[model samples]
Target chain A: MQLDSILFYLFAVQILFSALMTITRRNVVYSAVWLISTLVGVAGIYLLQGAEFLAGVQIILYIGGITVLFLFVIMLVPVSEESKQRRFSSQLWIVLIVAVLLTGELGYFLWQGADSFQMGEPTPPAEIGTVTTNSEQIGQVLFSEYLLPFELASILLLVAMIGAVVMAKARPGAE
Target chain B: MEEILDNPYLQPIIATLLIVAVFPLVAGYMVLAERKVLADLQVRLGPMRVGPYGFLQPLADAFKLMLKEDIIPAASDKWIFWGAPVLSTFTALTAFAVIPFSDKFYVADVNIGILFILAMSSLGILGLILGGWSSNSKYSLLGALRSAAQMVSYEVPLGFTTVTALMVAETLSMQGIVQSQLDKGVWIAFSNYGLMLVPAVVFIIAAVAETNRAPFDLPEAESEIVAGFHTEYSGFRWALFFLAEYASIFVICGIAVTVFFGGWLRPFANVGFLETPLNVAFPILLFVVIGAGCALGAVRVTLAYEKAIMGVLALAMFLVAGLFAIPMINELIIGFFWFLFKVLIFIYVFIWVRGTFPRFRYDQLMQVGWKYLIPISMGGLIVNGIVLLFTS
Candidate 1:
């Protein structure tokens, strides 16, 4: 096999294995660590796709920022007692139903193949050539075409942040 | 053989191997340099007994650490404790892949070079947090929390300052930033009517904090929590953490040198008359003076073995100076020397500040990072952006 396919299989296997580990682990911290590996595996996939910028953002924001926050919260809570408790929740039937539905949906898509999705064949990695322009092209598209949606997403984040601060703040003279 | 050598993948692989082989030794010597500088600042001799002028001290220290017993706390999380230092060291070394050491030497010149470095550094904090948590000690947990908070807070200003410089340089590529500086006939620090200096200064301050160095080293403050996160660590594991810390310090300072001071570019690069003297003659003269000093020390020392060691060092320096005189080799190494020279100055400044400044109280550290440095960096970025918008 070509190197590209070999790498694809490797990253796919890593993502699947790590995702499985993330859900199965009893310890929350261990789960978070596995989740980080899963995110990193996704990032590796992005890198193979020649989406360098997305891969970097995936690492920085998800693995670095968000997962650290998750770990911080996890560390503060007493987890020794929590881990010894039962694994499965009362909503097992609901979860299994959803899982089966999702699997069926994925299987259907696989059976239908590329034509049914109405998407074109992907641009080959060779055609993409130098990776430097990948980010520039992303910037051009983000700013020129998707500018409004992009700004709206940022504004939404800002509002959420302000709301969180307001909620977190001690009420006036509550002390 | 030619086909294998010509493989694009093989080049980066070789570069990665070279860095892995070389940087641990470099980090070792940086520790010696720090101790020597700190001693000089305090008016004392440091590590004189190791070899001649303590030149082999790092090697001796490395050997001692390696031979010491490796301990794992019985109550601790064994897996994480085992993995944490390795994780820390791995990320630090991986970040080096993007660092443009010289024009010819780098693992990969990926487009998102600066971003990749920043991301790696962010991931590096995980190693600290994990190490602290897994140690199962209050001091380790507290130290880890403080380190996490400090790095997270300071990263804001660091990111802003880098954004400001990236604006001026107009690219995120490490090599591209240097080329931009060359094209503009000025370093990024001096660009935009000196407005960029604010961010450069803030970048250095935030970097010192990010690397958990002195003044801002509240996380590892010996007096406070007894060595912080790695308090329970001993022997080679502790040494690994130490290596990672210095490697990250080098990486951060390297970014500062590349973005602000002009990586791999000689000072007065645009000035034609100064080029020959500064680039060629200056290094040769400096080496000659060092070689002469070593020779004098060799003669003055009473011990025969010490004198012989000093003579060997002197000969090495003289050989380097002689090599610099050759045109082809000069062309190859001049950029490397200047880059290293600037980085060494940066490292010295880090040590100097460590000696000069007192440790900030935890609250004071947080306040300085959030209230002072962040605003300054943001203002610098916005102001520089506007100026660039108008001018260009």
Candidate 2:
């Protein structure tokens, strides 16, 4: 096999194994750590391609931000005796069916997009011009074509934040 | 192995390895410098007894720390307790890979260099929280929680300020940012006459807090938290924490310099008359002054060891001065020197602020980060965006 294939397989294996471990681990903390490793592996896959920006965002947002939040909850909550008992419950058969269906869907998508998913070279977005950098191109798209959605998303987030604040606020007369 | 070694990529890898080797040594000296400067600010001699003017204090400290018994609490999570420091140090050092020491120098010039730095440094927060939590100490947990909250909060303003810098540069690559500054004939901080300065100021404040330095060091407030997250750590584990802290300080200050101040390029680089003389004389003059001080100290020192060390320091300083006197070496080194000099100045400000300011209360720190810094930074970003829009 070519070196590129070797590296891809390595990263893929890392992602898959860690992701598996994330769900299978007994301890919540261990599970979080495994999830972080899985995220890192995914970032590695992004880097192996030319998606440097995506790799960074993957690590920064998923591993650093979201995983840390998961860890915080894990650290704060007291461990219950039931938590370490088993990885699955009575719904395992149903969950297994769902998982198999999801996997099949993923496999179908991969097969459909196989030719497009060429390693190293991602298909460049339309309107390719002097702006070659991924980050700049992202900004251009986000501001120009996706401008309304971006603004609306920001507004939505603001509304959610304000709602959270209002809900979190103590009543004027009561504690 | 041979083929891999001979690859063009090996050069950057070798350079990275060299940097990794030198990093700890530089980080060690930073701690010593911090101690002595903090002492001087408070009118004390600091570490007087170590090799000439406490020059070797870091070595002594390192030795002491290494020789001390490594401790893990009986109830601690053994694996995590062992891994936390290594994780912290590794993540902090990983940021150096993309840091442009000069225009041509860096391990990897990734397109998303700034984002990579932000990501790596954020990972270091995981180290802190994990270390604190796994220690099985209440104080440790509290410290880690504080650190997580503080870092997460401050990161908002920090990210905004970085976005502002990126907007001004219109690029995310570290070298690209510097090149933009050079092309524009003004650092990002000084661009738009004065409008961009607010984000720079905001960046500095948020960086200090992000790095968990005083007045933003609520995570490790000694009086309240009792040595913070690494409270249960001892010996080499504690040293790793210290090393990571200083190295992050260096890296963050480096980012500040690269983004706000011009990286590598000398100030007023476009000016015709001042450029050559300023670049040539500045390094030489600095070394000469330091040599002279060392010479003075050498003459007055009583102990033979101290005298010898001082004499050697004086000689080394003179040697460096003479080295910089060469036009060829000076031409090559001037950029790197300017970048380092600016970084050092920022670091000095860090130490100066540490000495000057009392630690902020946790609530107050959060308030400053969220209430003051974020809104202002957002406003600054909008203003910058508008200016860039008009100018473009």
Candidate 3:
């Protein structure tokens, strides 16, 4: 196989394996570590697809920020007590049924091939003589075409931040 | 054979190997330099026994560390404890892949170079956090939490200051930033009608905090926490953490140099008249002066071995200075010399700060990051953006 395809398969296998480990691990911290591995594998796939900007964001936001927070929380909690409890609940049959149905649905979609999705051909990345880089293109499109949605998202985040602060703050009347 | 050598893939592999092999030695010497600087600042003679002027102190320290017994606490999480330092070292070294060392000597000039570095350094926090948590000690846990919190908090200002530079450069590539500076005839730190200096100052402060250096080094404050996160770690594992620390220091300082100060540009780079003098003659003159100092020391010292070692060092320095006089070799190495000169200045300043300042209280560190730095960096970005908009 070509090195590109080999790399893709490697990342694919790693993502799947780590995702499984993430969900299956008894220790929450171990699970978080596995989740980081899974996220990094996804980033590798993004890099393989030439989406360098997206890959960087994936690693930074997910592995760096979110996973570190998850680790922090994991360290804080009574993890030994939690780990002593059962890994699964009495609702296993229902979960198994849902899992099987989801797998079947995903398999069916994969078997149907690309024509069923009805997506257009994607534009190739810029070359030497082309206008700017992929990052620049992303920036331009984000600002110009998706300006409203971008601004709205920023406002939404700001609202969330305020809500979090207020929720965490002590009541004025109560010490 | 020619085709094999010409392969595009081979260069990066060679560069990677070269960095992996050379960086440890560089980091070791950086430690020696730091100790010597610290000693000088404190008015004490440092490490005179290992080699003349303690030149071989890093090598001796490395040997001693390697020979020491490895210890893993009985209560510690064995796997994580074993892996944490390795993880830290790996991430720090990997960040070097995107760092533009000079005009020609870089591993990979990725499009997202700065972000790649930021991501790698962020990942390095996990090493500290995991090492601390795995140690299963209160001091370790506290240190890790402080480090994680400090790094995360400072990263906001660091990011903002970087964004300000990126706005001026309009590129994320390390090499591209240097090229932008060259093209504009000004470093980003001095650009934007001098508004860029605000972010530059903030960046320096934030970078210092980000790397957990003194004055912001609440994470590993020896007085309170007993070496903090690596308290339980011993011998080579501890050395790995030290390696990661110094390597990250180099990487962070490198980013500042690349983004703010012109990466490999000589002083007065744009001035035509000063080019030959600053670019060529200055390094030679500087090294010759250093070699002369070494020779004088060698003559003054009474011990035979110390005199011999000093003489050898002086000879080596003179040889290096002589090499710079050759046109071909000078052309090849001048960029690297300028780049390393700036980085050494940065490293010296880091050690100087460590020597001069007392450790910050945890609350003060947090206040500086969140309250002072964050606002200043944001305002600097806005001001620079406005300046760029009107001036351009």
For each candidate in turn, the TM-score is 0.97, 0.93, 0.96
Q: State the fraction of real interface contacts model 3 keeps.
A: 0.37
Q: State in Å the error of residue B106, model 3.
A: 0.6
Stretches of candidate 1 off by over 4 Å are A87-94, A118-121, A126-131
Docking class of 1: medium
Among these predictions, the greatest lDDT belongs to 1
DockQ of predicted model 3: 0.45
Query: Which rank order by DockQ, best down to worst?
Result: 1, 3, 2
Q: Native-contact fraction for each model?
A: 0.54, 0.58, 0.37
Question: Individual DockQ of the candidates?
Answer: 0.57, 0.45, 0.45
Query: If you assessed candidate 3 against the hidden native complex, which CAPRI class would it receive?
Result: acceptable
Clashing pairs in 1: none
- Report lDDT (Cα) of residue B158, candidate 2: 92
What is the per-residue lDDT of model 2 for residues B1-392, given as tens digits with 9 covering 90 to 100?
A: 99997776776887799889999889999988899899999999999778877889888988999999988999998988998999999999999988889866678776788999999999999999999989988899999999998898888989999999988887888888899999999999999768999999999999999999998888898999898999999999999998899889999999999999999889997887987578878889999999999999999988998899899999999998998989988877788889999999999999999999988877788789889999999999999899889988
Residue-wise C-alpha lDDT for candidate 3, range B1-392, written one tens digit per residue: 99998776676788899999999999999999888889899998988778777888999999999999999999888988999999999999999998887887888887789999999999999999999999999999989989989988999999999999999999988899999999999999998888899999999999999999999989899999998999999999999999999999999999989999999988778889997898778989999999999999899888899899899889999999999999899988888998999988998888999999999998899899999999999999888888899989
Which stretches of candidate 3 lie above 4 Å from their native place?
A87-101, A118-132
Q: Give the alpha carbon lDDT tens digit for every residue of A86-134 in model 3.
A: 7657998999999999999989889998667876455454442122366
